[model samples]
Target: MVNQNNSAQSVEKTPSVDDKNLMNIAQYLKGVQQSHKRSIPPLDQWHPKHCGKMDLTVKANGEWWHEGQLIKRQALLDLFSSVLWKEEGKFYLKTPVEQIEIEVEDEPLLVSQVDQVDIDGKLYLQLTTTNQDVVVVDDQHPIFMRDYAGERRPYVHVRFGINALIQRHVFYHLVELGELDETEQGKAILVLKSGDLLLQLDS
Candidate 1:
């Protein structure tokens, strides 16, 4: 759960760039976090009124920044990440009463680690995100290649329509676990297996 920041004071305003309004929004989000029971809030079910855009930006390297300063609190990052919502190709920090858009330079999240887990003698690849989201690699959380930053990169599906970029070291680890297979067209493809699913790691 995210503790309230010193920036968020109890003052309400119609959504704008005002620092007071931003504070109110953050305060409301903190309240929502305190009241929620699940590890991840049910952002799918939330239909908050559009509260305009915030200056918050998720950088390409997975750092969160608001205004011009870096958001350095891990708890706050976790809190905001819990309520992250993507719709129609846009991303927002959503709560029960309001939704504020945030800029995403690349993918909204990052896969910081990957582990191979054995379940009943079957091996599965599990990915852990920067926000501590653990997701098993399978059809539900498939890994696919996409063009990003002028290069082909592997991205995995996180929850709620959010996808995470596999970090360079993590991708190196994945390459060590994958096998190269040739398609019917005779092109080599690197793939990782999790249970019965085969995930492509290259384009």
Candidate 2:
């Protein structure tokens, strides 16, 4: 009887908020990694039971928040990002058995790193997301800008129907590497990729 009582107490003991968050994230990463090894799980097709909303939120400035506290751990953030997806104009982390919604003030991703390389006598831009996933700025994937509050905000396609908002410093680097040119149709563009990709600039 005493052993049963002790076991019950152990099970009943609640973990701290931070501990709970970590456990959930760790479990999610484990499942996601296994599924990713084969291929991206068909999160869109899986009609999983809707889990309750998580307290996770991504701010406009690319900061992540959990339970109203800033999530400063990059590793945790990266793990959470691996399962991100968008549908019906909303972002979600769709695990195998549950789909949880997270708040996103802006785009769900941030391109925090940038690099330029010479490919066949032309420079190619490589952009890295917060999750360390890299995408080349090429013909199929091009950089774009939008006017936000009278300022041009830079963005680029991340992957699988998602886009990343370029960080301020990364955008500055792109500006330095970008060259102005004209297309055959006389549209002004910024030539950032080699051979083909000429990003159209809004006049």
What TM-score against the true fold does each predicted structure earn?
0.83, 0.75
- Model 2 pairs in collision: none
lDDT of 1 by residue, 92-112 (tens): 988778888889998878999
How well is each residue in 67-174 modelled by candidate 2, as lDDT tens digits? Answer: 778988877677777778887877887766667777888888899888987778877788988777788887667788877657778888876577899998987777
- Total clashes in model 1, counting residue pairs 3 or more apart in sequence or in different chains: 0
For residue 78, give model 2's deviation from the true position in Å: 0.6
lDDT of 2: 0.73
lDDT of 1 at 51: 83
Off by over 4 Å in 2: 1-22, 31-47, 118-122, 180-189
Candidate lDDT values, in order:
0.81, 0.73
Q: What is the lDDT of candidate 1?
A: 0.81
In lDDT terms, which candidate is top?
A: 1
